[model samples]
Target: MNRKGYYSIQMQAVCDNTRKIRDLYVGYPGAVHDSRVFRNLPLCNSLEDKCGRYYLLGDSGYPLKTKLLTPFKDSRQLNYNIKLAKSRYVIEHYFGILKQKFRQLFHIKLRNITFIIHFIRAACVLHNAAIDDEFQLNENIDMVNEVLPPEQDLDFVDEEEDRDARRVRDDIVNDLRM
Candidate 1:
């Protein structure tokens, strides 16, 4: 059982606009916060060196970093938030498609965390292969019904915002306004 009082495994993945998984990190207990899990990822450690000019769009649960841009919480930046959400919708859609195709992911009966992790990875690999084959999903499939964890914890507060990250986000907001 996790902090949310349920049995769950934390899986972190990054998918491209093409709906292909680019990076995957799994096996963290559900009790862990997304920000903490991301902070521990090897990808997070080397993101600056690897991404160069690219920036990853993350929800407010993640800390704003040079390579990872998160949405601003204030209502004043609604436009920026909307644009970011639209761009980040791909990952959410990908997860929905994955769960719909692999129904077992909804409720894995496995008890061993290691086995569960491997199982999830195998599913991801198969998902990529399906994408490679250009398999089309059922047109009627409803991706919106997929249950996702809450984006922000009402009780949790983030630390001080990074100056550089805030500047980058503000610049994007300004661009949107222009």
Candidate 2:
């Protein structure tokens, strides 16, 4: 329950990890799965849409691919992360600064899902503004075309976790109805 007995919402953000502005999304309580956010976040969609080779830096939350790079979690098979170390680190370091700026953002305390969405949008918009006066984005941005291991060969073990995650997401949303 929130300060008003309503379940608060959580906002998830995905960025290049070094850029001033991040692609953001607002989700309900208990919706912490990275795949969901990755699938739904408009920012990722927009960025990925732009033509040319674009590499999205992210953490363990989002799915791995040639375009969207993340740190090496395991050494199984030929992982693209082997050559992606430099570019991925940029996002990691930026995330640290983002968290420092918005401490309460990690635990957004709000009821209305719409308001929660707006709160995140507003934060991102401000960050976007800050970037205008700050260093230019993609200044040292790394752009490498490290091919991905065959999709069929790479392992993904989130089905079980996703099932439990969906249950919790449903519960939280249902609880809000009351």
Candidate 3:
């Protein structure tokens, strides 16, 4: 059981600006923090081993890393942060679609974690299939456009320790300012 007093499963997905899921990770319990799920995945290592300038925009719940950009928390940097937040909305939209389309995700009550994982993964697959088939979300559900921030403890990073990551973030911030 999670902190929510019930069994819960979480999914970490990578979505494109087109609001279509590109990749996903599943099977973590609801109590597991998003950053923890990310750290446990091979995805971070794979990206670190790559040579490109690719990066994923994550919300504040995620730790800032060279491969993952997160919004600036300072109120003074609100404008700059909006750029990252706006780009990150695609994943939120994808989640909104997934929850609305597969209502099971909204209120899952399965006792088996394995079943819950498969169920959520299947829903994601079907979601992608529909997108590939040119399906659009119903207007009624489309009205739910806002991203709901998850209730998880934010992971803190030492700016001095993650110097490289900070530099990369600053560079992106500068570029976005142009």
Candidate 4:
């Protein structure tokens, strides 16, 4: 969906601590921003615990929500923000493994977005299955890193600024101080 002749689809994924993808959403046009894709997804309703005790850690591209924690914009390297950012590595690692195992995702040349989405979904499922089979990817880690582009700073939009979400973030910051 790029204006310059490139067409592809985006994937939004959630990985557990086990490095296995727990939830995957695909089919958003490549031109669409990641935050929009995440907003439209029903992950909040489906993943929120009854006790409201669980939360998912997301990177800068995701909006802060009660159920999803994001680091402060232009963070000052506070301990709380440092910890959250450090913990977010798991999901990034999952993506790296998926793209490494399914080279198609590395440069999705398929014109049909639907097909690209299906391919990505299948890759995610296979990635998880491989984990279950005790697959070791340590050897491929360096090779994958070599081909991948350096991480870019994403421009995030605060689509829905909820006071409650801010409160939750503040509470976390305060707790870290204690």
The number of clashing residue pairs in each candidate reads 0, 1, 0, 1
lDDT of 3 by residue, 17-70 (tens): 667777789987767888888878878667665526688888877777888887
Q: Could you tell me the lDDT of residue 74 within candidate 2?
A: 53
TM-score of 3: 0.81
**Candidate 4's residue-wise lDDT over 59-123, tens digit each?**
66667787787777654535666688667777777777777688877777776767777777878
Q: Which scores better on TM-score, 3 or 4?
A: 3
Ordered list by lDDT, greatest first: 1, 3, 4, 2
Structural RMSD, model 4? 5.0
For model 2 the TM-score comes to 0.52
User: In model 3, how large is the Cα lDDT of residue 126?
Assistant: 90
Best by lDDT: 1
State in Å the error of residue 45, model 1. 1.7
What's the TM-score of every candidate structure? 0.84, 0.52, 0.81, 0.78
Where does candidate 2 have its weakest 10-residue lDDT segment?
Answer: 147-156
Q: What stretches of model 1 exceed 4 Å from their correct place?
A: 2-6, 138-161
Residue 155's C-alpha lDDT in candidate 1? 47
Q: Write the per-residue lDDT of candidate 1 for residues 38-120, one digit (tens) a residue.
A: 87789977888877888899988887877788877666676677788778878888888889889999999887888999999
For TM-score, the strongest prediction is 1
lDDT of each: 0.80, 0.54, 0.74, 0.70
Residue 107 of model 3, lDDT score? 79
